[model samples]
Structures are given as C-alpha cells and as structure tokens.
Target: MLSGSPTQGMFSNSRIGNSESPNSGASSSFTQPIIDMSENDETELLSITWNQDYHCFAAGTNHGFRIYNCKPCRETFRRDLKVGGFKIVEMLFHCNILALVGAVANSHYPPNKVLIWDDYQSRSICEFTFRSEVRGVKLRHDRIAVVLEHKIYVYSFTDLKLLHQIETLANPRGLCCLSHHSNTFVLVCPGLNKGQVRVEHFGLNVTKLISAHDSQIACFTLTLDGLLLATASITGTLIRIFNTMDGTQLQEVRRGADRAEINSIAFSPNVQWLAASSDKGTVHVFSLRVRVSGEDSLTQPNVAQGPALFHQNSSTSLDPLISTNTGANPNSTFSFMRDMGSWDGKSAHGSETFLLRLLPKYFSSEWSFAQFRLPQSTRLIVAFGSENDVIIVGMNGSFYRCSFDIVHGGDMMQKEYVRFIT
Candidate 1:
C-alpha cells in the first residue's frame, strides 16, 4: 500500500486537456496529486464499482473507465473507451470482463447498445443491441443479467447466449441484485405486481415471488449465498426480508414513518449485520442475531435469522402482514419509533396477532442500531468495506469512509472523504 495520506479533492478520470500549472497550488478540498488531461477535458465521473475482492475499483467517466488499486491508492491503468464514451459500466471481479452502456448525453453511441469489453485486451468482445435503452447491467461468471425498464434478459457470459427473459413491473431504477459466488446463482428483481419481488434460481431453473412491500419496490439486495433477500419500497419508510424458497416474510424494518426514497440495501459478508442508506442522507446499521434450531426466528428482533430461515421448511408461512401506506408523517420517524421501542407483544399479540406481527421484531422501528447523517445530497449509495468500515459515495462528487465500532454501539463517524470530481 502507498504511504501517502488521503485528503480531500484530487480525483478524476481520463481526460484530454491542459494540465494544471504548478503555480495553481493545492485545492481547498482534500484530494490527491494534481492532474491535467489534454484539451478535450470531459472526464466527469458517472458511476463507481468495486471488484469482488475489493483489490481494484473502476470509475466510469464521460471520457472512459479509470481503474484504481485500493490498498496502494494509485491508478493501475486507464482503459480508453473515448469513441462514444462509456457513461456507466460494470466489472466482473478482477477479471477483464467489462460491461458498458452509452449515456444519454453522448450522441456517438447508441443508447440501446451494450458493449462488453475485456480490459486484458483493451477491446470490446461483444456488442448487443436491444429495442429499448438499457438501464443497468450486472456481470457474473457464467451469466449476465441486463436490466431494461420493464424487463430483464439473462445471457450466458461465455457465448452471450440468451438463457431466460423476465418481465417486471415498472422498474425505472433498473433495480436488481445477485449472489457473489460463481457457483451460486440467484437473481432478484421487482415482480409483476407492485411492491413484490421475484427471485430466480438459474441453476435449478426455479422461481418464486414474495410480496415484500405495499408501494413500488425501490431497491433490493441478496446475501452472498443467495438464500436471503432484503427489499425497500418507494415509500421508503420500511424495508423487508424474505426467504427465496417459499417467499415467506422473515422481517420488516421501518426507516421512518415518513416517506423517503431508499438508495441501497447491503448485507455484511459475515451475515451478522445489514446496512441501508436513503435520500434522507442517513446510513443505518442493524445488528443481526443468528437463528437456533427450530426456534421461531422472525420474532427475535435483532439476530439474523435468515441463515436458519433458509434451513427451515420453505412451505411454512407465518400469518402475512398486510402493509398500508399512510404517506409521510411529520413525526413518523420519531413518534413511530418511540412507540415501537416500548410496545410489548402482550398488548398486541392475539388471535389475528395483527398488531403483534406488525411489531418491531423483524422490522425494528428503531431499525438502525447505529446511524450516520451525511451532507445533504441528491443521491447516496453504501456498502460494507469490512465488518467495521463502510464505503459511501454520493452524487455530489464525494466519497466517504466511515468507521463503526461495536464497543461503543457502532455510531459511524466519517474517517475520510475524497472530493473525487466536481
């Protein structure tokens, strides 16, 4: 790893512009070494993603893709895709498999075309054209899931062979997630019904659906092994977890009674914790308790019962919890949480157990055991870097590294920030 310290300001992708003069001096924001591309300087960054091992990360910019090594904090190499420019791209681990989608801002490339590249050769190996514009692309070892507005096409990575096609409800965000292991294949997407999620098991050729929310599903994620799934709706106040086997609702957590758009959901590698971020500028951490044999894990309130839930019978269904959208409440985040923190099951548990089932166990009203408020921004995405560290990036052109210490209840505080690009 490089010995130099990381400050604010100094990062950008490939460019063709005049270099910064030495007299220009240091930037007010904490960035790195100064840079200057050539004259056509359109190096604005659009998206960023890390490889499976986190050894390297790729930043998609208007000019091309910039690959950076994490530990040493240096540029490994720059892959020029300047012809039309790749506004967004996905990398398959540390391998050379790269996926590209043209941005609306670029006129040179077709928005409906996908260019699959191999960094090893610095060239695109496959060119795929679709009827409608592509919203997102997910790369895997054996298969690739290309997300369109209302449909998803799965293709074999080796041959680009069409394997299956799924139609979804209005999925404008192109929200989808999959397992990390090459051997375990699980694909999740919004279901045909609003607020529902459809799970696809490609290896077994089986599928299941879970009614996860009442409003439209905003985003969702699958655990490393693909057995557990977490979902959030457009309403944004709540999140739910479901079993892929029988589509049983395992847990439900409230972001706040007030409506907020969910930005992302992630599961820790250890499966000991779950994290979430929203448009509200808050990143939350929830501790998970592992389930024991035959115990009804859903009502535990904290431990991650999903590992055990997957082992349990898939045919069993707990009394379903129908959701209602009362819209955003001024005191929704606070008042609802206060009530949840103290309400006991005795007062709510009964024949229907409606109120009890709705209690905060799975969806703890105070879902966030630890939370961090970020600078107000239009977009935010978060992922666990290590058990105690978090990596967050916002549309404001800033990247953050935060630390969560369990010894102190894990209240995350920003440890580092880099103003990558403006």
Candidate 2:
C-alpha cells in the first residue's frame, strides 16, 4: 500500500538540521533539496516505489515526482510539471517510459486516467482512461497492468492492446504483482473469494488459485522468477510462501504474536531469503528453506501425461516430508544455521511434529531470524539490497540501508541513512 501524505501544506523551504543517532551511523544528507520550493506551489509526497531491478525508485508527489538512484542515494531527476500531482509513478526498469496515475488533489491529471510518460519526449505519449480511479499501475517490458478497485486490466506494451481482464475482490489497495523473469510471465492478484490468490502463468496459459490465508491478504510479493510467492494476511502474524505453479504451500513464517497491518513483503533476488515490513515499524528477514528449481521444472504442464503433470507430480511438490528435508544437507544446514545466527535448529517442522505432537501449531511457527526496528509511526516498504543488505523506504521520507549479520541474527547494522524528502 502507498503511504499517505504526512503534511497537507506545500514543502517548507527551511532546511532541517541533521540529527545523528548512536546506532544509525552518520547521516548522509542530500547536497541540495530535491524539490524546488516556489513561493506559491504546494507539494507533499504521495508515493514511493522502487524500480523492477531495485536500482532506482520514483517518488510521486503532489507537485509531480522525482527519481532517485538506490545505492548511492542521490536524486537523479525530477518532473515537477506543476500541472498536477502524481499518485503513482511506476518505472520500466531504468527506461524512459513510465506509468503514471494522478493524485486526487489535481484535476488536470485526474486519478481516473493513466498517463504513459516518455521522458525523452517530455510528454505523455499515450494515456489510459478508466471509469473509476486507477489504484495502481505496474509496468513490464512486454506488458502493462492497470489496477482498479474491482478489476485488473492487462495490456500489451507494444500497441497498448487490451489482452486480459481479471475480476478480483474489492482491491481498494490495488494489490498486484508481476514476475520480472523473461522466460515466463506471471501475474498475481486477489481472487474472486476472500483470502484467495489468483496466479496467471502466461507462459503456459494456465491459472492456479491458492488459498493463501484465512484472513484477507494485507500484502504479498513474488520472487524474481515468479516461481514462489510470499503472502501476509490482515492478521499479519504469519506469512505463507507458495509454489506459484502448483499452489502448494512451501513454508510459513511468523512475524510476531501481536496483529500488525503488513505494509509490504519482499523476496531476495536469489529466493533464499524473504523480508517483510508492517505498521509495527520493524523489518523482519527470514532465511528460506525453499530452493529455486531447475528450468525444466518451469516447463509447461502436460495434463495428458497423467502423474507427470506439473500440478499432479508429488516429487516436485513441497509436501511436509520434502519441506522438512530442505536445508537439511550438511552444507546447507551449516549455512542455514549461520544465517539464522542464534536460532536453534529446533524450529524445524519435522522436529516439532516428533517432539511436540500434542502442542498447538503456533508453537511450531517459524520466527524471523533478523530484524531492524524503525519508528512505529511511519509505514515502510522493505526490499533486499546487495547480499545481506536490506533497503527500506518509509512514508516519512526516510531511506535506510541496513545489513544483517549472517552469523548473528538479532539486530541489523545500519549502514546508511538519508531523508529523501524534507
């Protein structure tokens, strides 16, 4: 979900002094203000989203939007058109093309229209207008997804031809995620029923439905290859991972005992780790027991092949037995233990089932191995950076880069910090 504005008025011209924290390290402030404060213009941050590759992010503001590079933490450019503000600005990798939706504050670029902006041309080359406000827009090299309150529209990127329409449950948050892998195209969205997820595998022309949770889905995300999905429910205590192809539950990890409004969930590039952020203001990273299968495992399903079918094949599924064996190998177990830091190996489901057969399932739930605490007042989104590093972007205009110790999993070391907007 996108974060709401912290203040209503235009941005202040007065520079904010740097406040150093004992644990946050030395703050690296931007040399100049990213936004130009005109005497009459009013602006506030409406949204911030990282690009597909996590290299850069676009910040949507009431006045316009700005793009910033991720690693070095510097403003690359800004598009303060002044005509209206943008509620969402989605980038296609580092390309010049962007999918933009307008904020409610500006009628010039209303929320009902999606403007396909071309940075090279410095104008909207094409636009998609809808009956209702566009809640979100996602862009890929070959496709564009326009998310509405009750429906999602998929279009071909080449000609903007409508390809498919998916009916979903009330998706006020415009929850949608797409696979970035070139070999396959997978689109996941809310299903027709509550707590259900519809997975569209374009490569195989098949759709799989997974009942991810008993409660409504609060947040979810996919691995880069689109093979695995991580989902959190409105309860927000546990996050479940599923095999996108077969709708098999691979693993489950708990966020906490208390309920939280999960804001975002992210999978590491290698699919070995998963991270989640919520209203609790803490980012949790879990070492995954699931492994990415070979390319042959992603082959199209052969329904006529009987037991060999992808969906029916038990060997490929992460059944209880198979799931328990994950990371059980000597080398993998050692690595997993190292990554888990102080985590005892007792959390394994197989061990729990054997020793605590009469205990409640809650006692068997997997807890996060590492965590990074932030201000609880702000809603933040988390994503994996390089290796053990995690990148966080908050509604409070704060950006953080923290690294977890693979050998000690409690608190993450803050490597860098910056206030992108002030």
Candidate 3:
C-alpha cells in the first residue's frame, strides 16, 4: 500500500519530460506525445509496486501506468489510456499480464472492478466486479487473490473459479501476501481478531493462527520459500518473525523505540537478513539469528541451528540455563561462566548485562545493525538487491541503490541514484 495521502487532479495526459540515461549518461526522451499537455506540473502517483521478482516495478498514475526496469533504472514502456487513474497496478513478474484496480475518478474504470490487462495487446482481457471497492489484488501463476474491506477471495487464474474465501477484520489497506515458491502455496491475511494473522498452508492442508502483536498489524511479509513469516504491528517499534510450519515465535527485532508508521518489510533473498522502512525516514537492516531448514550454512555461519530446535512441541527454550551446553567445552574451566554471560550470540556480554537488565525491555531489544536515511516527507518502499545492496523507490519518482557493510554494519553507501519521472 502507498505510504502517503492520495493526490487528485495532479496528473494529466501530458508527455513527461526526458532525462539523462542512468547507464549511458546521455539525454533520453520518450516517444512523441500521445495526448496534449495540461497546466498541471506533476502527475498523480497513486501507487508504486515492485513485481514478484523485484526486477521491475509498475507505477500507477492518473493517465495510466508505466513499467520500469529496476537495475539500470530505465522506463520499459507506458500506456496512456486517458480514460482514468489507477489505484493499483500489479505486474506478473516480467510478463505482459497485469492486475489493475482503478481509482475513484472515472466511471470507465471503476474502483469496484479489477481489470486483467494484457499489455502485449494493450487491452483488458477480463474483469472482476465486486459490490464494495477493491482494496488490493495479488497475482500468482495459478491464482488471483482479491482483497476487500472485510473479505478475501482466492480464485483459480486459469478459469476464474472461486477456490476459497476468508473473513477478516477491518482491512482498509488490503493487507495480504502470498508465497511465490513453486513448491508451496501459502496465503496470509488478517485474522478475525486484531493483531492476529491467519496463515493458510495449501500444500499441507493446515491452517495456523498466530497472535502476532498486541495492537493492529501494519505490515507483514513471507519468505520466498514460505517457511518464515515477518510481521510488524501498528506500534511499529518491533518486528517479529514466526515459523509458519508450527506458529512458533522465532525472533523479534526492534526498528526503534519511538513509534512510527512502517511502510514495508522485506527479507533478503538468502533469508539471512531482513529490512524495514519506516515513516521516520530510515531504512533498517537486521541480521537474522534464525536459520532455515535447507539454507546454506555459509549464509549465516554464526547461527548454530534453525527454528526446529525451538518448536512449540519441543522442550527447548531461549534461556541460557536450559539451552546452553556448558559440558560441550570441558577443557576451559570458565566455559559455564562464559556461556552464562552470553545468552544469545548477539546479546550483551560481561558487565553490560547488568545495566541492560535494569532498563526496560525496549532498551535491551535487538536493534537494527545497518540503516539508510532518506527524506522523511517522501513515501518509500524497500527491496533487497544483489550482494548486500538495497533498492529504495519513492513516491516522488526517486530511485536509490545503496550497499551496506555486512561485517561492520552502519550507514549504507549510495551506489546509484536516478529520477525515474520528472
């Protein structure tokens, strides 16, 4: 969902001005104008969403929508229907198929309809009409999930057959996510109670309900393999990770002590790290302590075991006295003392533990190791890139690529910047 208020009448069918190419450093211009320019200075940017693979993104505007490649930051193509504005334009990876929902501006493209557009033919192939306005639309290879105010419907993409329906709380932001893994079908949506999440595991024919937080859920995401789930609440100070297989709370990471609106949360491709963007103009990345079942040990050498050790049915606990094996290192006389000092590998050691114990839990919470600062006023979304880099896209038509130091985490170094729209 967008992080800022929607602007009306700010966009026109006018042709956008050209800018320098990101790679060639030469001036580049779009094709001849399809419609005459208006007096407006800026186009209404309704929403910006990355494709499933994060290699490209679609920008929904009043005129229509435009697709752009993310790496070199170049516009691939645009369609100026001139009919109305689009509130949501979700691309199906790099394919020509797109799921589009209209803004409340024109009757030609109503807000209560989801149009399946095949950009190759430049026309909508089929449409789904609803009684209430459509809040969100997610597309998979074999399914199409639609989100409304209080209900979610999953449909078979091949024949548009209804497969499942779920009742949820008041979800105006259309909070829902799907796992894109080829071997798994996992769907997550708001539960009947606030701060709750309902996970639907289709492959296993199991449903797990997890109470994620005390307040309303703001944002959540799932790993590509559909094994781990990350969630953030309205408080926005803490982000929690859960094991989707057994509904176990694996770990919790703090974004900050001050409450702020979390715009997005993303897990690294390797599942060794996580990143979150907040309204406070900072993007935070944290090293994950929990490991996946089949993940490469080289990805996170420090972590000893995966979440399998902390299953709900298991007797293991995070307490050092129960989980630590002091006898494993018998050669050292102070091995027990050393293990007691370090509860988790990332926790405080020696005298620092005494001071941390006196303070509130917020003060001793696990904080982000790396951060990138941006303009607080600009609404942005974040995604992981190659190596330790991150891709930030803003509603103001700005794109930034920054890399973080994995060994010595701190501020991220800017690698590239571009004004995608002017």
lDDT of 1 by residue, 1-422 (tens): 11221211112322212212211111112111112345466567777766654556677777666666554345765655435456667877766566777777656545676666554534345556677888788876666787888888877654455777889987778888877664457899989998889998776677888888778888888876576788888888777777665687765566766778888887776665578888888888765432223323333332334344334443434422111222122122343543454445544323223554666553325356677888675577777777777777766666777877654444688788776655
Model 1 lDDT, full chain set:
0.63
Q: Mark the 10 consecutive residues where model 2 has the least summed lDDT.
A: 19-28
Distance from true location, Cα of 93 in model 3, Å: 1.1
Question: Which portions of model 2 show Cα errors greater than 4 Å?
Answer: 1-42, 293-316, 319-351
- Superposed on all Cα atoms, model 1 deviates from the true structure by an RMSD in Å of 12.1
- lDDT per residue, candidate 3, 159-185, as tens digits? 555778889999998999998866668
State the lDDT at 421 in candidate 1: 55
- Local distance difference test, candidate 3: 0.74
Candidate 2: residue 80 Cα off by (Å): 0.8
TM-score for each model: 0.74, 0.81, 0.79
Best by TM-score: 2
Descending-lDDT candidate ranking: 2, 3, 1
CA error at residue 37 for candidate 3, angstroms: 9.8
Quantify all predictions' global Cα lDDT against the true fold.
Answer: 0.63, 0.74, 0.74
TM-score winner between candidates 1 and 2: 2
